[model samples]
Each structure stands twice: as C-alpha cells, then as structure tokens.
Target chain A: MGKEKRELTGAEIFWECLIREGVEVIFGYPGGYTLPIYDALTKYQDKVRHVLTRHEQGATHMADGFARASGKVGVAMATSGPGATNMITGLATAMMDSSPIVCITGQVPTNVIGTDAFQETDITGATLPVTKHSYLVSDIRDLAHSIREAFYIARTGRPGPVLIDIPKDVQNAKTEFVYPTSPIVLPGYHPPRRATGEQVSRALEMINEAKRPVILAGHGVLISGTANQIRELAEKGNIPVATTLLGIGSIPDQHPLNLGMMGMHGKAQANHAVQNADLLIACGMRFDDRVIGKVSTYSPKSKKIHIDIDAVELNKNIKVDLAINADLAVVLRQIIPGVRVRKHAHWTRKIKEWIKDADRRDILNKKTDVLIGAQVINKIWEGTEGKAVVVSDVGQNQMIEAQYYGHDEPHTHITSGGLGTMGFGLPAAIGTSFAVKDREIWVVVGDGGIQMTISELATAVQENANIKIAIINNGYLGMVRQWQQLFYNARYVETPIYSPDFVKVAEAYRMPGYRVDKIEDIIPTMRKAQAHQGPVLIEFVVEKHDTVYPMVPAGEPLHEMVRRPHVPSDAKEN
Target chain B: MQHTIIALVEDKPGVLNRIVSLFRRRNYNIKSLAVGPCETPGVSRLTIVTDENDSIRQNLVCNNLLKLINVIEVEDVTNVPTVIRENVLIKVQVNAQNREELKNIAKERNARIVDEGERSMILEVTESVGKIQATIDVLRPYGILEIVRSGKIAITRGDDRPEIKNGVAGRGTESSRATEQVNNYLY
Candidate 1:
C-alpha cells in the first residue's frame, strides 16, 4: 500500500504524538501564543480531555498529582512568560519526587524572538534546573520527534519532568509528519542496566559475610517495581530493612523484617539499627542530608554499598564501598539468586529485642485525653484500612504521616519532599481525586500550610471532588516551632499562626466542615467527613507544643537521639 | 589546576546574569569567559577558563552550568590541545616618518589595516595572546590611541569536534546520525 506523507504543523504533530503516547488528559490554560495548540486540541477532543485550570500553578500541580497517583506521565500546557514561570515550582517538586510529567509551553513567534515582543519569555531557560530535559521547537518538523522524546525522557530513567516550548510561528508552520512507534534512541541518556556478575557476586559475599547487615530501601525500590524482589531477598537472607521517608512503602510496614523509617523523626529502633549496623546495603536511595545527619558520623562503623539508577548520585554524597549503577528491579532480580539463604538468628533476635523494648515505651498507650497529630493520622489510616490516597503538606504533619501511616501500595502517599512546598496538599488532593475519582482521597495539612492555598477549596467544590481534608491545627507551624524550641532556646518567635473559622470558609464554598477537639471524637469526625456527599474539611486541634519523638539533632547520628525530650518523672523511670 | 570549559546554552535574556550569579553563588573562580553566537540558531557557545580542580570544575559543569535550563552541554577542554584567539582593534597615532615602520611591523604580524585617518591608523590583529601582545608592544612606539580586545575564543586541535561532543549535530556519533540528518534538513 502506497501512502503519501502530508505536511503537518507543529501543533498538529504535538496533538498526534500525545494521542500516540496514550495521553488521555491535559491540564492547561490558553494564551495568545498558545492559541494554535489549543485549536489543534479542540479538533481532537475525543482523543484527549483538556482541563481548564484557574491558574498555571494549579494546572501544573494537577499534572503532578495525576502523575504521582497513576504512575503515568502527566501532561500540562501553558503559555510563555508568567505562565511558564509559574510552573517552575511544580516542575521542581515533580523532579524531586521523581514523578513523570511533561509541561508544554508556547513561545514567541520565530521572527520576533529576542525582540521583547508581547507575551514572550524563554520558557526553556527558566526551567533548566527543574526539568529532566527541555526542547525549544524553532522548526515545525522537529515537533513530533521532540514530543516523542519528551515523553520518553519524562517517563524513563529516574522519571522526572520534561518541557517542550514551541514558537507561535512554528506551531502554524507545516511539514511532513511521521509519528514514531518505537522507542527513541538518545545518546548518553541510557539508564544503567542490572549490576554486572562481579558486582552481584561481591554484594552477595558482603551480605553473607556480615554479622549485622541492614537494608536501607528508598523510593527507587518502589519506582523500579522491585519491592517484591527486595522482600524475597530480605526474607530469605533474614536481613532487617530500614526505609527512608520516600521509601516508606517499599516493603509493607507489617513485615517482621521492616525496621520502619530512619533518621530524624524515625523509629527509635530503626535509627539505632542504622547507626550500629556493620554493613548497610543502601538500595535505590540518594543519601540526602536529612537521612545522613552529621555525614562524617553517620554509619561510622558500617560499610555502605550504594545501588542507584543514576550514576551521578553513586558517590556524590556519602562514600560507598561498592557503587553499582543499575535499575533496582533489574539489580534485585539478579542479586536475589546469588544471595545465600542463610538465617542470621543473632541479628534477627537483636532487632526483635529492640522492637519489644520500643513497644513497652509506646507513646500511643499513654491514655492521653488530648488528641495528638500522630494519633489522628493513625486513626485515619486505621479507618481507611490503609486504602486511602494520603496527600500531606510540609512540616510536622508530613513527618508524622511519614512515620505513622501504613502504606500498603506504591504512590499511595504523595508529598512534596525535596522542595517541601507548603501549599502542596490541597491542590494535590484535588488533582488526585480527579485521577482516581472513586477512591477515597485525603489531604492531611497543618493549619499554617493549609492557609497558604486554601482557596483551592473552590476548585474541589466546582469539580465535585469528594476529597476529605484533615487539618492538623496546632496553632503554629509545628515543625518550625519544634526546631526553635530545641535549637533557638524555646523562643517561639513568629511560628504562631492565627486562622479564621475553617467551618465558615468551607461553608462559604458550599462544603461540609467539622472541628474535633477531644481525642475520643477524632474517629467519629473522620467518619462523618468521609460520609459527606462532596468535599469535606475536618480541623483537629492538636497539642500546641507536642514534639515528634526520637529526633536526631540537626547534625547528630541517627542512634544518638534525644528520645522525645522526656519529662523529669519519665526520665527517672528510665 | 587551570581548566577550560566549553558550554552550549540557549541564547535567552538574563542567561549571562544567571551564569554570573551561579559562579558567584557557587564560589567558582572564573579567570576568563567568552560568549558568541553558534552555528545553530537560538543556541550560543561559551568558553570559560577557571582555576578550580577537576572535581570542582566538574561540579560547576554538571551541577551549576547544566542546571541552567538554557545550558544544554558542558565540556572540559583542559586536557585537549587547542588554539585560542582574540581580535583587538587598536587606533594608533602615526606620522609619515613612523608610518612605514608601523606598516612593516603590521605586515610582519599579518595584522590588517582597517582604517586610516589623518591623525591615527587603526590596525586589527587576530592571533594568540603572545603574538597579539608582541604586536601591541611593537605598535606602542607609534602612540596607542584606542585599544579594544574581544574575549578569547578557543577551538580544539585536530579532528576532535566539540559540537558533536556537546550533542550538537554535524559530527554526531553513528547512532545520532539520523538526528543529525533531521536537524540538518530542518535548519
């Protein structure tokens, strides 16, 4: 069959490529230069559903939420200048969390570029640090290839955001278009494969030889779909696994070998194990500053073996005894067989003893009448049966959720980690609700953080998203207050936050709201909020000065923790 | 250790400011820098020399320069043999008595006589720093009027193509030849 290739504009090619990539939805707002792409999108309404956002920032966060929830490349479109600049924060957030997103923007016309024309800005230049890669389409013919490449780059190899800026003239200019069906080949962009045989053998030898070995799992394990493999290896070898904050769900928390989280605000036993281990098999995690407090002192006695997908991150921070650059799943698949099925009865017994000792000092068993943030989050987790998509805002509430919430699924808990953007949860929840409308979506935010982007409530009302908003109101920025208390000699300073009646605000948006002050009313209030027809906001007044326990001071090793600043009487008991 | 780094960045507004800010923020010591238009539209080439060690230089290349959305490629040319040149146009005061001597010196150095007014003569010299300095020394006798020198631009010797290494087309590797062809056709 003879088929003639016809000329197509960049805008047309972009739509076609997006359809080919199975992009069913796009969130964006149109402007002067982006009108052509919008026109093309109009022609393909059946193939793609475009969500018009109130602002560019909302659109980007929506894309981010979609990506985080569905594990697919989220797409957003915006015009140049302020439209593109507003997307930088969202893009950076996605980049940090390793979410796949593609941000498309319009550029000034080809002829008037650099002339300071109306609605012109170098969108590509502004997003360099935040994106995995970027392309500026000056020619129409390159649009199809660029879009395909953008999708590939965004979805593969340490998944992150990629941007493509198309000039107005190029969008209208026509060329022969060919949609690529196969994977695009990019030089110098190959993601590392499984570890070599020598590396696996060396790793196995270390695992078998060590008397005390711990697995430090990170988000890379979950991203690579190696959680089951990791579990199998850990179970077979009787290795205790400690997870980073982002790696919370890499292994089920209920698993006996799981040591919970490590570092500041981590479980006491988990941090202790990390500090005292003889060998740390760090899998799929970059040792961020938070994880390795006082870098020189962290793991002073342990030999660290780091495995990561990005080669650049292998030795960028803490030195590794063995650095293997490979996909976690591939590496795990290969290493699991080589590992000898040996039982470290001594190591398992020691960890179990520590866990038992920790259980005796269980903070939840104190029978406190006052509701706490941790208790509230734990109740929500229990009520939802660990099935809800939990979106957390930054600060103490985010840390508490990371510590206490039991995540049984991948991408279940969405939070802004690296950037730690405060106003991330509400919009992110709204976005998550859209991605999986039938599932129960909950936004857990602090009073201070919620006030930043509370206006997005109107978006929930408009979209009819039945999202449950849980405000852990502590009357201050709890995390900052805790830091000030410890580091700043308890001088509260400007951490205090005063807010209006959240019920009134929710009512103003025609949504239901509730306030829970007593510890006994927490579960019932959450139940009522969940039972509400549309979006519901529940405010919980937590203890004003309560601190998250087992905190490693700013530059202290994980095991050398303050133990929750115990009262004098409790200290006497110890 | 002195090192020369070549980078390709999108030619956009405030790029220079961002580059300067990055250097200042990262505390990287920059000895010299040159920026100019490249063969591809919308992209410019920058050559910078610094005295930082290899690791620090690599950090500057990967973490700082490459972090800039506009910057597409960064390469270290410290170990590569290269030719560096700059153009300087100097207007000198000369009379009939010393004109012949100055002209002879200029001819010897292959400098071009751009303009000659009644009071002064302007000579354009394109050469290495040492040769340019020698020519300037020779012309100092004729009384230098105005001197303006462009920043040093460098290219590696032999057939090592920096553009291809930087992921630009023309001399890309075998796998990238298709992209090169497409890029060529588009441009």
Candidate 2:
C-alpha cells in the first residue's frame, strides 16, 4: 500500500489521519509544546471533539477506559516533559491490561530536542518499556503515517498503548500529507488469528477425555468477542468456567457453569475447581502470577491447553501441555464443533458442595452495624439492575466490586487488572460514560485510591459526564492494612491516612454530593444521586477494618485460601 | 551456556534502542552484540551472544525479540551447522626486541599487521571465537596496548534459512487476504 499525497502542515496531517482513522473524541490537555496541534485542532473541531482532562494521567486513563468500554482505539494527547512523564503510570496500566490507546505527546522543537529546552523530555525513550511501540516523529512527512501506524498497532492484535511523540518543529513544518491508502504494513507485527489443525485436534482430544475440565477465561475472551463461543463450549462439554478479574463479565456471573473469579481473593470454589480439574483450558488470559499463585503447584493435576493470540504468552508463564497461539474467538469456533456433548455430573456435584461452603461465608449474608464496602457495591449493583458499567479502582474496593457487583455482561466491568493502579475508577468511569452514553456508569473507588486522582472530579463536571462516583471511605488503604494486620503483626503503618470531606470536595467541583454513614441512607442517597442528570459523588463511610476475604497469600497454591472468618452467632460484633 | 542469535530488523531510527532496551528489561545479559546492514536493503541484521543456559529462557528471549515491532525475524543459530567469525585488532607493545617475534606470531596465527606505530604494532585477526582467544593468548607475552573485536557474525553452512515467522512474507500482496487464508488453514 502507498499513500495519497496532499499538502498540509504536520499538525494538520496529524488531525487528518486521526479523522480518517475514525477518532471521534480525544482526551487531552493542551500546553505550550502542543500549541501547533491544538491550533490545527481548531479547524477540525467539528469532526474531532477534545475533552480537556485535569491531568495528563487522567487523559491516558480515560483513553484506556474509552478503549475498554467501546472496543475502539482511544486517543490521548499531552505536551512534553512533566506532562509526558505523568502519563507513564496510565500508559503502563493500559499496556499491562492490553487496552488499545494511542497517546500523542508534543516534544520540544527538533533542533533543541536534546538541549533540555523548556518542557522537553525524551518521552519516546521514557515510554518505550510501557508502550507496545513508540515513535519520535522527527520528520514532518512521517507525521501522518506515524499517527496511522500508532492507531493500527494500538487497536490490533494483542492491543496495547502506542505512543507518538511529535516535536514542535515537525508539527509546524509544512509537508505533503501522505495518508496511507491501504492497510498499514509491518513485517514484524502479525497477530495470529487461528490455531493449527493438530493443536485444535489435540485440544479437542483433551476436552473430550477429561472428566473435569475447567475453562479459565481471561480478558482475551472479551477482547476477541468470544464470550458466546466460550459459553457454547462450556455448555457442550459441561465444563466449569472460571474467569480472571478482567474476565469477570465474559461469562455471566450467575451462569450455572460459571465458577466466578479465580485467583487470590477469588471465590473459594473457583480456586478449588482449578486445583482439582483434570484439564485446564486457559483461554485468552495469561496465567498471571496472581492468578496462578505458586506456579509450581498451580493446577498440578491439570493437563493444560493454552489458547492466546500472543505467541510469547504461550509458554512464558506456565508450561502448558498444548499451546495454541491464535485468537480466542477463532480457536473457540474451531474447537466447539469438535467438542462432544458430555456430562460431568460428579464434578458438578463436587463444585456445588464447595460453592455451598463459599456461600456460607458470604459477607452479604451477615448483618453488620456499620456500612461496608461490599454492601455498598452490592447495593449499587441492585440499583443499576446489574446493568451499569462499573469502573473499579485498585485494592479492597476493586475486589469488593468484583465479588459483589455481579457483572452479567461483557465490558460492563472495567478495571486496571494487570497493573492494579489506584485512582483509575473516576477517569475510567468518565471515559466509559463518553464511550457508552446511555448506559449508567459507576465509579467504585476507595478513599485512598480516589484521592490519588480526585482532581478528575472536575473533569467529570466539566465534561458533564453522567457518572455516579461511589467512594468506599474506609479511612485506610484497606488492602495493605489487611496484609499488615494478617502478616505484619497488625502494624498499621501509614495505611491510616486522612481525607478531606468528599461531599464538600464534590460540591467544590460544582457537583451534587452526599455522604452515607448508615446502611439505611445508602439506597436513598444512591437513588438521589441516580436521579441527578450530571456527575454525582456519594461517600460511603464503610467499616474501617473490614477485609476482603478468601485471601491467597503470595506464593500460596490456588486451593490454600484463607477463608473469611465465620461469625457464628450474631454478626453485630466486629 | 552461550547462545548466538541473529535478527533481521527494519533499519529505522530507535529500532536498535528498542531491541537493546528489551534485552535490558527482560534481564537477558548480552555477552556481545554486532549489528550491520544485511543483504536486503533497509533491513539491518543483528548478531547477539547471550549467556543463558536454560533452553526455556533462550526461547523466551528469542520470542521477546520478535515481539519488537521493528524486528522482522529472529533465529538462535547456536545448535545449527554454521560458519561463525569474530575479527579482533590487537595493538601489541613491540619496541625493537619483540617486533620480529610478534610478526612470527601473527603469521603463525593467520593474523595481519594492519597498522604499525613507533613502539606498537596492531595485528588484525578474523577467526572463530575460540581461535581468536587462542591468538590473543599467544600474543599476551608482548604487552598488548589495546584490543577491539567485532562481537560475532554467523551464517548457515548450507542453504538452511530461518523460517519467515512474521508478516514479511505477506508484503506486496494483500496482507489481509493472505492473513485470512493463513487463518483459515490454521483454524
């Protein structure tokens, strides 16, 4: 493929490529270095909408959220130096989770690039490890092609962030805009979309022979849009389906065959099933250290059949018996036809018994005097009818939402799964709101995580993003606090951090806010917030020391979970 | 165990940086590296010698190298029947006494006197890694002032070639259609 040449400034060419790539919105913050691009943006304002973010980090995360929610390439823009450095965490988060985002940062003018000029930074070098690929567009003629390539690389294959750092002079330089007319060509980058016949046959053979097969579904299932196929495969073979945190909504949480999330803090039944299953079919998800726990002991009994698009991921983590490096959707389509209808009655009966035990320890079943994070998440789920898009921040709040929110649809639950970045919820929810206009968007964040990027409240207000923010105010970094309490002789350390009154903070941002200390006020306040048309913030002051149970301490095997302590009689006492 | 890997990559700016950074990030220790333009235009070739004994880790490093967007192809030619060479230039302190002895050593080791200084003579040697070490060992009796060695370069002895594992083979043709056909066959 060649280019269609036309005369335009590099900045204008950037916008032209973006417009042709179908970018409707760009989450960005303008600065001195990026003035030329912002200036060019004025001419294309109608075609491309720009949402000014509170910080460059927010912009990156919003772009990430937009990509995850919309399944499209999300774009974020920032200037050089500090602005570019600030987006590192967000870019790393997106990269870790395989979210498709293109971040454009303005560099100093080419002549002074290495002189340490005002607001100049080596952003391409800085982001090289975090980004899937990065470019320093020094030449004006390469501007359009770089932007196109960035978009293509970001959205295709194992999707991740791709950064394009354009120098100021390059943006101002006049050149013939050579827009790529055909599909961009990259010799090194080929995303495999199918499995080999031998691999598929071997996988089918394993699937047919195993009495207890467990499908460990990951974010790949959702990314490849193979949830239906996964469900079909599970039903045809009566295989139990377990999901990673990012894979939560791929299989409906309530499906009979669904074993829920599997990992540390995952359901006890899911963990046990993985440990006991004869055949472990890992689909679209890497066996993260967190998911696999002690790798040597992880799924020790299972003969593994691994399917993923990324070839590097095949034997990188757990050495599987059969590795099928291909797209999950295509692989599932091929294998589902060969899988015979079978029954695993004994395995199902065993899992049902384990589920009963896990349900007995369910925190929601107990009555507590004070509010809890789990209850707040469960109530939000109820209020939204389990239909709202929930963006969760890291730590206990994220786990609580994953456990209690009960996501029933794919893309409904968006979180920074691999990186576990705090302060992701609000901006991500805002991005989700932009991606999905009609669906109710919710931010489930902890007080600690929310404070990390609390400034995004203003972004939500300015964008008029109809997102309901739920701050699980536990007055501590609950996840760390739990670890300290359990493993560090209860030394609280700096976990007990203070926070400003969130309601007043929300009000300062010119958005309606409410604080709920009692369980009774939770639903009412939530209802009031939902009734509001714009962004609304609700602070739920939960029990300070409540922990996320079913904890599999680091290096422990999947089945060796520290179950939630059973409050035998009255649940009133702490 | 030392492994020799060769890669063909797009000769674009920062491509070398990406490859080197990937090695650093992955903690794969590179014992020696040499990069130059290959027979193909606009495609650079890299020969890297990494000290990794684990076969799994070696495979991982090769896979990670291929993950780089500029890297077109990668192959570990350690176990293959191949011709490998390293060129070394050693400047040995000669003076009047040891000059003839140095010349005799260079001739015996198939080395050449590339440069001669007032008091030191530079001998260039192109040989296998072990032979180069042997030549250097023989010249150690004369005080060596400086040494520069091309890391490594390797090629197959016969017509054996590394498989085209990436999308380079689909170039010029409609890659989308080619990919679809490949997908159909694989699926």
List TM-score (chain A only) for every prediction. 0.95, 0.98
| DockQ category of candidate 2 | acceptable
Model 1 chain A: worst 10 consecutive residues (lDDT sum): A564-573
Model 1 scores a C-alpha lDDT of: 0.80
On lDDT, the leading prediction is 2
lDDT of 1 at A566: 32
Q: How far is candidate 2 from the true structure (C-alpha RMSD, Å)?
A: 3.2
Runs of candidate 1 exceeding 4 Å displacement: A1-12, A108-119, A167-177, A180-185, A353-357, A437-439, A532-534, A565-574, B5-27, B33-48, B54-187
Q: Who wins the DockQ comparison?
A: 2
Q: Quantify all predictions' global Cα lDDT against the true fold.
A: 0.80, 0.88
Tens-place lDDT per residue, model 2, A394-436, is 9999999999998888999999999999998989888888889
Which numbered prediction scores highest in TM-score against the true structure?
A: 2
Superposition error at B49 for model 1 (Å): 2.7
User: For residues A109-161, could you state the per-residue lDDT of candidate 1 as single tens digits?
Assistant: 99998898988887776776678878888878778878888887787767889
